[model samples]
Target: MSSASKDALPLRHPVRVETITLRPMTFEIAAAQPDFAAIARHIGVASLESLKASYSLSRNGDRVKLEGKITAALHQTCVVTLEAFPVALKVPVKLDFVPEAELATLAAGDTGEGEIDIEVLLNEEDPPEPIVDGVIDLGAITLEFLALALDPYPRKPGVSFDETAPEAAPESPFAALARLKGSE
Candidate 1:
């Protein structure tokens, strides 16, 4: 799928923007029946369930911020043994979104952006096309951030490391020399 298609997938629960304000805005959401399968798909995993995000969002001017916790259970293939392992995560997430123009200004040695991109700014190397809508999608932002934080190699408990077989013992040169001397 195209990157645009992937990023544009409908958010299970979208945060509503009541009014834009210069002051930091805060709100909480208890995700309604989160689509774990969809989330897993976003993370390139299979069959995730019982996922939820209880998060708060804040905005200051053109910069948007998200701080929250996500709890979920997932089934992932172990990188070592290839066995499926169930992993649970409750992670604290924080991120920031900044306007592209402001980011450029910062890169040009202007500290005037006020460090809004310090936490979760888009990659400087390949920044995303600027979000046209002043409104930010905090739910989508948090989910993507959580996906980045997931363990790529989840292992099942009690899995043992492989042991190498011992090598055969070699004959001692001193013992051979002593036997030859005795025979002489």
Candidate 2:
């Protein structure tokens, strides 16, 4: 991979896809011990015990496809109880990287903004990703998938949020007058 492409990736723990070909390629990456702290902070976890990912890459013409899974063990604070707990997660990953030139060509022909169907794009079998500088950053991809898998409002077991209904709007000051008016 070129130096510029390398620089585009996260500096702490980078899992870059350098080579692209029709033949299948695979990679196994583990976060370095020194990078754990930074990664933990990035993921908003108390601590990250470990993070590992395995990826397979293949190319069809100019489009690149990546399939992988990430496993992570971490500590997180419960949103309801404010207590820290351990969480182990496995997240599946799949991506299709389309060339920028091709995307540009498509964009050039897209003169009608309202003609685009967002629902169709969202429902596609394979989510399309833009290839930046002819490379894919698997480490960043892993993080993104990890975030998506995590529960935004994690709660400890047996913890339930019983939201007490707001107190009845302070008895209206004009209640007595209103009651009298109604009776009359």
Highest TM-score, which number?
2
| Candidate 1 stretches greater than 4 Å from native | 1-3, 6-34, 110-132, 166-184
- Cα RMSD, model 2: 4.3
Q: Estimate each model's TM-score.
A: 0.62, 0.76
Clashes of each: 0, 0
Q: After superposition, how far is residue 150 of candidate 1 from its true place, in Å?
A: 2.0
What is candidate 2's local distance difference test score? 0.77
On residues 1-184, what C-alpha lDDT tens digit does candidate 1 reach at each position?
3458646654534444335455555555334445555666777765576666665555566666666777767777776688877778787766666776776665556456655444445665433323334545655655676677677666668876667787977779998999999999
User: Which regions of candidate 2 deviate over 4 angstroms?
Assistant: 1-18, 112-122, 165-184
**Distance from true position, residue 63, model 2, in Å?**
1.3
Give the per-residue lDDT of model 2 (tens digit) for 1-184: 4667555544233333356668888878898878888778777888888999998898888788888899999888999889989899999888888877776655456657635333336655754777766667777788778878888898877889999999888777699789889999
Quote model 2's TM-score. Answer: 0.76
